[model samples]
Target chain A: MPGPKIGRRGALAAGLALPFIRPAIAQTAEPYVMGSLFPMSGPSAEFGEAFTRGAQVALQHIAADNLLRRPVRLQSEDSQALPQPSVVGMNKLISVDRAHWVLVSWTATSKAVAPIGDRAKTIMVNGGAVGPDLAGLSPYFWNVIALAHLEVQVMVPFLVRQRNARRVALIYVDDPLGDGILGQLRGTLPRHGGELVGSFSVPRAAQQFGPVVARVRQTRPDAVYVASFGAQNAQIVKALRDNGVTQTICSYSAFGIDSLRTMPEAEGALFTSQKLDLTGAHALTSRFATDFRARFGQPPLVYHANYYNAAYLFGLLAKQVETAGGTVNGDSLRAAMLATRKFDLVGGEGEFDEQGNMLTQMQVNEIRGQQFVAIG
Target chain B: MTAFLLNLATLAAISGILASTLNFIVGYAGIFSVAHAVFFGLGAYGGAQVALLLVPDPFLACFVAALIAGGLSLCLALPALRVRGEYFVAASLGLQMVAATLFAELKPLTGGIGGLVGIPRPEIFGTVVPVLPLALAALALILFLTARLQRGAFGRTLQSIRDADSAAEALGKNVNAAKTLAVAFACAGAGVAGALYALHLSFINVESFTLDQSIQIMAMVIIGGTGTLWGPLVGAIMLLSLPAVLSFIPFIPPTEVGAVQQIIYGLAMTLLMIFRPAGLVGDQTKGRSTS
Candidate 1:
């Protein structure tokens, strides 16, 4: 220990030689800046935090897989899921941060920023907003998840033909998500031989559904379909049951919300969700499930899976761009995406259409004794 | 960064016009209506319809929007302004709620919650005027007009009615007529502001005209100082810029910025009321009763 001790002059010499000894330290590639505009505060902050968590885990897997030699840096802007903050935050993300590729959520935020992103030629990958209008928003804008029309289109036949629920009542939220469902139903139900007997719309912020429930009950629908999200879906079900409506109530993936296992009102409800069949010998989804569970001590939700897939796709695309002797940017990445329209994701495999929109398989499932038992 | 600042400045300008008009009604006219955003909504929808259906002429759109909002102001003014202060506030609140519902439900006009999009930029003389410059010019015009209105006989009549309606009425001032006219004029300014807002954002929706938005506009007037020409403008700039300014501080954590902003706004509002009741830029020499 005494022999190893260095004086100030020796220490200075060693410090001076360090950079030359490890020259590659100075040659590391610059980090790729990935921008994520989300509701980092306000009512939707939980979803934002969860999306960030998925991305964090994705970085670990991206490194383990050696998808890209260069590191990726995630930059976030709090949109608060509103127009004003969304516009300002989007401009900051594009102009100041210089993140050519951004992940955006919320229907309003997507619509507000679509024209701006298109003007700047920024690649905005939306995985959360389900608005149908987002389908044809911009050439630069792409959707990684199924839009509302697809979900509702797939859901209607399952309710009508499979369940024999011809006369259906709808309780929908009055925002984009609900409007998306509403727009689709206008065409979908009549085509599927199902009639919409009663349709009730509650504001996005409506907490009390007594008047709505009373109206819906009066219609005496054979089944009730709730085009809603979060706690509202469960609240609507509870309101229907409390008002003595014995209708076969159902919804999309929202029926399997986190609190559904504990809520008796959500029992017997069927939903449509995308699930990867991890039955192969070395399935990527099975491995991801194991690793995600080991890391977070909980199974990943659909949102977590979606965000993880979004980040994982970026890594794959970056590798493709670099391999093709092009810089990884919005245009190059978008080109890579279009060239390879199909992707194998941890959630499931998907194929992007000519419109840069992807649709996942929606498997029907039912809740039996708080367990989500798949039907098909 | 410059573009970001420009975005914020455009927002501030739109908010400046809104706050200035609210200041006229609440501060000068002695009407504490909380439904100022309804007029703003009316103007926004009116202007949006005009620009989308007719031409993108900034002047024509704003003028039509202002006239529409001014006429509708009578609905709130005749019923609410003649009542007590608290009842006027309640009436304004109800108006905001009803207007929000109407904006959302009137699918043919307001786009049914998805909002009206693809609105072109302000075109003047067949040349497109940039949104930032247009917004700032509108704010200047509103402030100048407010100054002239607050200083002349119009201002005296409002002040006299505000100080004591009976005394003003005894002196042959038409209290109801003056109050109604003041509301219409103030609402017209709000309409112009709303038109600029629609043009600036290039999108309009019911969310922008909710009770929450009304409260924010009211807060701008109260925090800046009521009854003063520059008070609401200053408040608009300060409140709109608070989040950006806080991000520059080295000690504050990024996650705590929003919370810290709310805390600062609440504290500033409380301290201003207790120590400087007139507001940061409120007029103190007007002999206006504070209590």
Candidate 2:
């Protein structure tokens, strides 16, 4: 049977529709994989829920808001908050799940996984782990959060100018993040005419701070900086108060853990963090809080917001790449990110340097009655 | 998929090597020492330092690691001479704890908690070797040597000492020397495994070689059947690959994966102990320890 011949007008209409149909098919390609490597099983498992929910919420937004031309899925592995496990998780994320872009947190885990990410040529976006060592860990690596170096740059001068504290004694955890902060304070303090009187490294298992407290007292500094995190901050601070060695205690945003902030020991302690107003007011943050609470039945924490920004940023970057005749992978997305350095994150507007480190306005805050209050 | 499988294989082989060497001590010599991870960490630091400061030759790294770990084995060997059975176990545990602390504090050489990161991939004659092959070859060599040693006279002497310590000594068996030699050789083998572990992971930290790691190696030896040659290999493969397999299951929630994996692994171990007390691959008649 002979097919009916199309008229000239019909033939012209079909030809014009070809371009639209081809692009529509292309836009429906297989969903890309976004991966998260976090401590989901070990001591730091508490961070896992927020990290996972944050990314999932962002993916939900990407779909609801039509943020990307194609769909994307999230795959995750447990890092156990250690380097060795992180290597294994990172391998599975890259090789098995085919995650070309990975989100990493936890300072040591981030550092450990970077080599694998580099080897696989995956774009690794770090939303947590503010270690200065991660600043340029790999060409494929970039930070969605400010490194501790930036916090130190904004903080030490504030301490010197506001409190007139010149000699700063450091009590830091014996880990990469703490080491990075210490390195920054070493250079940052000196640059501002301040001296690092003594720096004591504390292992993760340390409990009795009597020796550390005595050593810090011996340094006779005007201010003490606690570069440690979590419950240890409270212990060190309590020991300092108990010893009657009260100077303006300083730290970074890692001090925001709920346990540390609520304690009487952390009273009057100051910390520098990326400019984020915790109030549920800002447009993006408010929307995110609503979405998070709706989905996860709780308000988001600081880390959740950071990871949400990471996931949303990925979708936006992928969209931009697709619009510009590229696919979402290490090279393509990285070039797109470098080109578009200024992104409107869920918290606020964030800027990135050539090294792909997202820079934010700095805010100094104090723990006042279990709340983080901006200290001007 | 290929890279992931290769990584898994490399890890499994490293664990297998550790299990086999541990079997040589715990199974063959009846040395119930729990400080095997100390040797692993010593070797890891040794190999990592060499890779970071010098060339990343796998052979050179292995050799240096063996010497470093073997030299340190005197701590355990001397204690083994004075202690018997459970006393030696306690001494070995103390060593593991002390070694872990040292590994974390030796910042100049070990890089402290951050560890020797970015350890270049191992190379032989300026050629970058694939990690799985290197690990697999190492595993094969350890297994072969173990089989050969088991049939030799030295194996019989150790067997006699394990089954009847005082009688073997009265028979002019040079008991102390045999124990010392067994501990050193077993530790050296563990050091070799550590070298390959560092090479495979391309990073090493104090966390990787902890008391938990020693317990894991012990479990592999016990679950796989200590006296049998392929026992450790079976146990290592089971433990190392369980999580990977569980991850593939569609019904399990992503957040519940690790917890579920632990339950399954524990359940498997319990079931194995109940069903096959000698081990999955062990001969019940010969694998028992009278010492």
Candidate 3:
């Protein structure tokens, strides 16, 4: 009886020491390193800020739920939305930080850094870039956002069918994103029985849309397809209305409801958006939206959802690798990701195709007086 | 860390070549030409095209690109040289704008806004030249050539022209020809740098060759010590490496790193200007003359 009593006392003492011992064991496991490259400053800071915050929130949730086999650490670099700086940032992330995964945010940066990723044999996830060229570029490259071509593919039919647009004039910003959308529209519009009347390319930072609007008006098209985004999109819309050109204005998802609020003329304009309105989303998406707003003090942009989905996918893949008795690495993680048939994300349930492009539904929303109402 | 350092070194070498070219115009020749980035773009687009279409050899492509850039510089020099001082600066700025527009509009050649992608990596003797060693070699070659030029009569002529163009012309120096040669040589260096840059990054766009880039290069030259041969290299290294170093600091969040880096860079430049107007390695005696 005395021996049994002493054993029970020893067991109690061991249990008392378990809290201190558990962390020590946990500390021994190597952490997963994720390098995030964002346009944290410069023209695209809004998107970059959203991406960083979304990823942070995702990481927090993963940690809270103990979703990963090992602790995960994220290190971020600023790309500044330029190619040269982007390359430098990528190099630092891969070589200096020895990151296992890199999340890139822009098309030019993703393209510029692709060679590096291929050479380093590191997994790169693109949460924001949607260049058409990115499809099938590298085995290690994964795109979480819908491709720009896909958005245009969805838009052209909407213009012809839903909006009854016949002759469409194109006014797009002169950049890779704008150019990709224009190319897609040119090829798809004729098939839809829509005539391409006139097109004008303006600089990304062009403030003077008077000349561009004048040229667009000369065509006298039934609808003007604007492939601009951000503040420039607002400027173009204002210029179009000011010039008395009242053709139905359709745009790529360049301006959100907030951006359009500043330009009252943008009301009733049709645009394609990858982001769902959180108020009417699935329960999971609504919860994510609520959590994001609480954390960031603002509603999440589409880019935020993309990055959050990426982080969650990464966590699941890492857990799968661990469960299979395999180390989490580029190769194993890639295999795990490829094997996954579907993912439930903040945007919606989707899957990655063979080319690593995400297959997700985009919403065709119409701006109705300071709000984007989903039409089709 | 090694690979990152190599990347940084490669960028620094490319930047050194560009800043040195600027130094030749602003420091030695006192032209203050802002069209250097235009010539740089010419070299990149032209050289990449040649490598992709004509020659598989990157070295030959780079040489041809430099020659093409040098030839193009004469076009700018002809009209720009007709003016003097501030007028010359204005003329170069106009040329810069024209070149930028051409880069954006020449869709067939430059790939327009989509930019030229999938640029083949440079190879030599059936082996791809690792970007790091190639970049270091390029730096060595550029430094050697710059040093040779500085020691030769061309350097003295440029210096004399910078001091007093009238006196140089009076002494039988063809001021116009000297200026033209100087611009051509400087632009060739910029072109060579651009070729390497395009190859290393494997992509190029009009955005990379904007007026802002030209101003950044000029800042490097001024910060490094314009007249000295090694000053541009030092400045290039400092400016290019500053961000990487700041990125390692733990206190600054990644979101705010860029803004903080810019502030630190600006503060450093201001302090350096106040303390060492002649530059870190510039000879006080050979400092920029007001005249």
Instruction: List per-prediction Cα lDDT, in the order shown.
Output: 0.78, 0.83, 0.81
Sorted by TM-score, highest first, which candidate order results? 3, 2, 1
lDDT tens string, model 3, A1-376?
4454557778968645543453354347667878898887776776676688778888888898899867787788889888898899888888766678889977778888888998887889987776677887688899887777788778788888987887999998787777887888889999999888988989866888998899899998989988776568778998999999999998765555356744689887887767576887487688778888898787776667788888778888888998999977888988987898588888677788886788888988888867677788
Point out the higher-scoring one by TM-score: 1 or 3: 3
Q: Which regions of candidate 3 fall more than 4 Å away from where they truly are?
A: A1-30, A261-263, A275-277, B54-56, B284-291
- Residue pairs in collision within model 1: none
Which scores higher on DockQ, 1 or 2?
Answer: 2
Error of 1 at A47 (Å): 2.7
Best by lDDT: 2
- Report per-prediction Cα RMSD to one decimal: 7.3, 9.7, 9.2
Q: Ranking by lDDT, best first? A: 2, 3, 1
Whichever of 2 and 3 has more lDDT, that candidate is 2
Clashes of each: 0, 0, 0
lDDT tens digits, residue span A1-376, model 2: 9999999899968755543453244345767889888777755666665677788889898999988776887777877777766777888888877786898998778878888998888988888777677788888888887777778888898989988999999999988778887888888888899999999989877878999889999989999998876557778889999988878888887775566667887788898877776564778877888888898776566678788888888988888998998767898888888888899877689888888788877788888887777775
Q: Could you give the DockQ of candidate 3?
A: 0.30
What TM-score does chain B of candidate 3 reach? 0.93
> What TM-score would candidate 2 get against the native?
0.89
lDDT of 2 at B94: 95
